[model samples]
Target: MRRSGPAVEQLIGALIPRPLPRPIPTPAPLPNLPPPRAPTGPNRIELDVARLVRAGRCSARTLLHQLDWRPEHRLVVDVADGTILIQRHPGGRVLTDPRGALTLPAAPRQLCGICGGDRIVLAADLTRDRMTVYPMTVVVRLLAEHHARLADGRRGR
Candidate 1:
C-alpha cells in the first residue's frame, strides 16, 4: 500500500521531463592563419571550391554546372593530412561489392564525395586532392574536452 524507496523515486521520475544535452560548440581559429592571400588562378579557384564544399548548400552536380568549367577543370579539396582530387571524366565512377570486386550500382551519384552536408569530405578524396585536413584547432578543443571528461570520471561522491 506504501512505497518510500527506489520505487518512489521512479514514480516521481515518470512525471518529470528531462532537459536535452547540448551539442558540441564550434571551436575558435588557431592563433595564426596567413594574411588573406590574393585570390588568383588556382588559388582563387581553390578558395571558391573549398567555400562551396563547406557551405554544402547546392548539389555537387549543380555546383559543378554553375561553374564556368569543363571536364578539363580539376579541383582539389585540402584537409589536415592530404588532398582529394576530383576528375570530371565520364565512365569514371566505379562501384564495389561486398567482396571488394568491381561492381555496378543501379544508381550511383556523380558527386558522392561531397555528398555529406556537415562532415568533412571523405579521406580518400582528401588524398586525391593533394590537400591536407586542417584539424589542429578542432583537435585542441576535443582534447581539452576529453581531459575534462577524464577529471569528471575520476571524481568521487
Candidate 2:
C-alpha cells in the first residue's frame, strides 16, 4: 500500500545494521616460552648436545642473549618427521653471523645435528631461552664408527 522505496529501504536497513566501528583490539604479545626440554629419560643425542654446548662447540648462552629468548618458544624433537622445529615467537628475530654458524639447515639434509637433519644443532639465541642440537648425521656417523670399532665384539677395550 505504501511507497515501494520506503519498504525497500527498510528491508535493506534490517539486513545490514551499521555500527560505529571501533579499532580492532591488537593481540597482546605472548609471553616468552622455555627452550626445548630434553625428553624424559636419557637420550644419547641430548647428552651429546650438552657436551658440545659445554665444550663451546656451540654458543647456546650467547645465542639466547641475542634472541632475547623466553619460555614461549618451544624446541621439539619430531622423530616421525625426523626434524627439530624451533617454534619462535612471531615477532621475535634472530641476530647472528649465519656464515659463522654451520647450521644443518643446508644441503645433505640429515647432516650432523651440527650440519643436517631437522634438529638444528646450531645455537638458537631466543629472546626467552636457548637450545642446541648436534648434527644427527654426525651422531649417526659417530655411532656407526663406534659400532664398527666393536665389530669384533670387545676386540679392543
Candidate 3:
C-alpha cells in the first residue's frame, strides 16, 4: 500500500539532506573619491600612418608638431615587443631633420622586423612626450590574434 499525505512528506524531508540557508548579502564599501579638477593640457593622443623609406626614415611631421618636437631635436630609439619607440632624450643618436623627417636606426628597424615601403602606425602621446611605431607585420599579427579569440568565443557559445 502507498501513502500520499503530509506525514509522508515529513518522512521524506527528514531522510533527505537540506541545503543550508543563503547568507544575507552585505553592500560593498564605497571607494574614496577625489575632487574633480579642470583640464590643463592636451589629454588626447595623436595617431597617424606613414611609409617607411629605404633609408630608414619616416615622416610624422604632424604628430611631431603636435608634441612640440622640432627639427634638430634628439630622440632615443628603442624596440620592444616588435614595435619601435622614440622619445626625446638628451644626447640621443637619432635626430629630427630640418625638414621634419625622423630617421630610425638600422638596428631598431631590423629588430622590429620592418623594412622599407611598409606602412607603420605612428602614435604620439603628447603628455608623455613619446612616439610608438607599429609595423604592418605586427599590426597584422595582432589582428589575427584578436580574430582567433573571437572565433573561439563564438564556438564556446
Provide the global lDDT of candidate 1 against the true structure. 0.35
lDDT of model number 3: 0.88
lDDT of 3 by residue, 53-88 (tens): 999888888998988998889999999999999999
lDDT of 2 by residue, 1-157 (tens): 5665644433577778889899999999999999997544433222223233322233344454455443344333222233333334455333333333322233223332333123334434333243444356656776899999788678655
Predicted candidate 1 versus true structure: per-residue lDDT over 1-157, tens digit per residue: 8766765333576678787899989998789768995644433232222222232322233224333323334333222222233333334453122232111121221232333232332112222232222223344566899999999988953
Off by over 4 Å in 1: 1-38, 46-58, 61-63, 69-83, 94-117, 121-157
lDDT for 77 in candidate 1 is 28
lDDT of each: 0.35, 0.42, 0.88
Model 3, residue 27: what's the lDDT?
94
Q: Which candidate number has the best TM-score?
A: 3
For candidate 1, the C-alpha RMSD (Å) to the true structure equals: 17.5
Residue 61, candidate 2: alpha-carbon lDDT: 46
TM-score of 2: 0.24
Report the number of backbone clashes for model 2. 36
